[model samples]
Target: MTPFRLGVLVNPLAGLGGSVALKGSDDVAEQALALGAEPKAQQRMLQALSLCRPHFNNIEFKTASGSMGADLLEQLGVTAQVLHQLEPEAVTTADDTTAAAAALLDSGVDLLLFAGGDGTARDICSLLEARGRSDRQVVLGVPAGVKIHSGVYGITPKASGEVVALMAQGELVSSMMAEVRDIDEVAFRQGQVRAKHYGEMRIPEALKFVQAVKMGGQEIKELVLDDICAEFIERMDSDCQYIMGSGSTVAAVMAELGFDNTLLGVDLIDCDGVIASDLTASQLLEQIDHRPTKLVVTLIGGQGHLFGRGNQQLSPQLLRHLGADNIIILATKSKLEALEGRPMISDTGDPELDVALAGWYPIITGYHDEVLYPLQ
Candidate 1:
């Protein structure tokens, strides 16, 4: 039997800055390392590849040399043909990522599995665009970076592996074009978010594993927002801590309460006012303090994801603490209808929590208006 051609690439320095609170690992990899940050891209790659062990004989691996790809495969006792070689003792860079992607494309792999953040996704997507092969090449991203606004990535490392495993088993997984987006690291560090679209790449459409491109901008329904906000504000308890999630729908609620909103990041608020703006995952967990906290979130339009799109700050630990009943979901009726009956997804990177979060819940659509929506 012919084996599935699997191309693998890893950005060795992808998420180094995330642990040390640098916001992103674009050009500040050295500074991140200076802060005692350890490399995690290869470890994340290991998580994905480990799950593919059972189907090893049915898959042919191709990758770049060293930490870029071959090193991790070697560690797993899997042999891969090194199509691109990096200079010995040289630090990996974005150029290396692109060059390695070019080599993989030239080798004609069925799917290219890349482990990195949005920046890495942009490198590979840009190369495909430059070669006019965006439609032809199928790529998948394993989330190992601080900034993961792109839609090409799997919800988690294990989820990405599961998708590849399906292909290895000869399952008919369809492909779809997912957007590639990145935020300016400088602005992000300064507490301002400026996400811009780079391009799109074709990825396996396994909705249970892959996330959707974040819907940007404000909702068009002005009066419906007013009604929704009115209903939410009426129910807001002054004693409870509210974790305001990212997105315009949630921003509308903040605006109604006369509090400053982080349009693309998490914010902490209460009846008193904005407690903190633009918090990291650790900062958010610190502030909860076992207080009666509720999370105000909106689904990613067209995708119907309640968690794990742009709100990674709501880490699984925090979600479990807040409990599922404390979550307040806000979305327009049109947005829910657009899903065409697909259930809302919660790819929180914790399979157990995702299952716990599933069930029917009332979604605030307008004043005294709600529809029972299923979150899976």
Candidate 2:
């Protein structure tokens, strides 16, 4: 059997601005780092590739040199052909991403699995478009960036790996063209959103795993949100620490409580008020350790992802510590209906934890209204 050639690329600075409230990591990678932002793209890439380990023999890996790709593969004990090399001491830039993409595409890999956010997608998309190979080449993204408006990414890192593993095992996986969209970090930080379409790229059509382009704007049903917030506020336990997950739905809960919210980052709050704002994975773990904690999360509008989308701060360890029973999912009935019967996904990176989280749970949709929903 001809081994499936998989090209891997990692934008090391991706998602560094997220937890620190920088909105996006584009030009301020250094500022984000100075504010204590840790590089997460590599770790996220690890999560996806770890799942591909069992199918290693069936796959041929090719990647860029150093932190861009080879480092993680080396950590996994997988030897990959290095098609592009980078200066080990220099910071990675968009040019490096494009160069790596060009090399990988030229190598005739079956699939290009890159890790980064929307900007990274644009880099790869531009390269493919320049060569007029956008339709012929198949690529997939592991969501590691702060702004992920692109449809080329999997809903989670593990989801990306799952798609690759299926292909490695000789399963038939369809391909489709997905749009690439990105927002202006300048406007984004100023509390204004300016999303623009960049281009589209071909990707595997794993609908269950690949996310749709993020649904922009706020929820139109204001009253539905009011009722959901009412129900959540009414049920708050004074002794319990609430780990507020990101999303407009969850933000409404914080608003109703008269507390400021991190719309795209995790927050730790209690009945009194905000305990901590914009916490990273380690900070979150430190604060919630051994406490009676509950996670208030909502699904990504069009993606139907309950975890591993924007809120990577809720690490697998944290989710396991909180236990499945401690989670409170909030969503509007209309949002649930948008899925058209697909189960909400729990791509928390840990496949075992994701499976353990699968089951029917009551989703609070309004004041005194709870609907039973399945989370897979």
Candidate 3:
């Protein structure tokens, strides 16, 4: 078997800003730093390179000039020849990214490993299509973005590392369809949520996540999650007050329990989905005069995130009470591969809180059957 000739490209500007802070990344640079999105692209890029180093000892590592991909590799001790870069300390733009990717293809690399989110994916896709070399080039993603809606990325850094190692081994892997999705930052800043699909690529599924399929049937879609949740609610078995996180799935349980639940808001429920307090985090703790409450949640379709992104009320205190074991994840087969391997992401306003829920956890996508999905 031929050991792979891999091309490494790092977008040092990626995830430079995000919604981790009280405020998300601003359209301008001044706004990015205010929200704690410093120029950590270099840091994240180095991390990905550090992970790549162990696999190839004498491989040719091609990168653009500057922090785009060159400096990051240099810092990680990758003594490969530089590509078409002019500076090592500067940052690379999307223009530089596409050009360098095309250069790497002409030089004959086995796979092109890129570090960034969906935006970076779009650039790579453009280059591949321009060169008519999409099929010849293999790609992988290192997750370091705010909204990465691509199946080319692994669920987490660790999972991504694992996928790359397997690829280096020359195993029979399949190229998953990596789609291009970008949120309209301008509109989003103006409180309008707009996401557009740019394109698709077939990368190795062993690396990234698939979007969950959307459940159907007004009757059945409404019934499965609700019925399952209702049975679990009835079995709460203790006065351990409950917190009802919002969603139509959770609403099903409330429907069975004869309680009117807010479909989009977090609700505090009894062990039986009875809304005791549809309050905020502070209000939730106030209403719970008991111990050991459980948090019921379901995976999001197309993203697979359970807590951090949608429900903001499952705070650290709430998780401590619900416990990891008590955190229930529900999804249907239809929505399991929405983005392929990208685990459901949670952006619950805290980066530390978000990473705390990292690692793989058991998800009940069906009755009595569970799949271990990454939650980082």
User: Where does the lowest 10-residue lDDT sum fall in candidate 3?
Assistant: 206-215
**Per-residue lDDT of 1-376 in model 2, one digit per residue for the tens?**
4467789999999999999999989999889999999999999999999998889997789999999999999999998999999996888899999999889877767789999999999999999888777865778999999989999999999999998887676443455678999998898889999999999997875433221222444544777788889989898988899999999999988998999999999999999999999999999889877578999999987788999999999999999888766899998766776876667888989999987776545578777656555677
Give candidate 2 regions above 4 Å deviation: 207-376
At residue 59, candidate 2 shows an lDDT of: 78
Q: RMSD in Å for candidate 2, one decimal?
A: 21.4
lDDT for each residue of candidate 3 in 1-376, tens digit (9 for 90 to 100): 2334567777666776664542223244455656566665556556655565667663457766676667666667667666666454444567777778777766656567777767788888877767664543567777777667777776776566565665554332344446767777777667787878776665654523222322456666655565466546545656666577776666676776777887877777665455555677777766655565667777667766687666776777766555555676656545655546555576666777665555444455434334444565
What are the RMSDs of all candidates, in order?
19.8, 21.4, 20.6
Candidate 1 Cα outliers beyond 4 Å, as residue runs:
207-376
Please state the error at residue 120 of candidate 2 in Å: 0.2
Query: Which regions of candidate 3 fall more than 4 Å away from where they truly are?
Result: 19-36, 88-91, 207-376
The CA lDDT at 376 in model 1 is 71
lDDT of 3: 0.62
Q: In model 1, what are the clashing residue pairs, if there are any? A: none
Clashes in candidate 1: how many? 0
Backbone atom clashes (below 3 Å) for every candidate: 0, 0, 30
* Structural similarity to truth (TM-score) of each candidate: 0.56, 0.55, 0.50
**TM match of model 1 to true structure:** 0.56
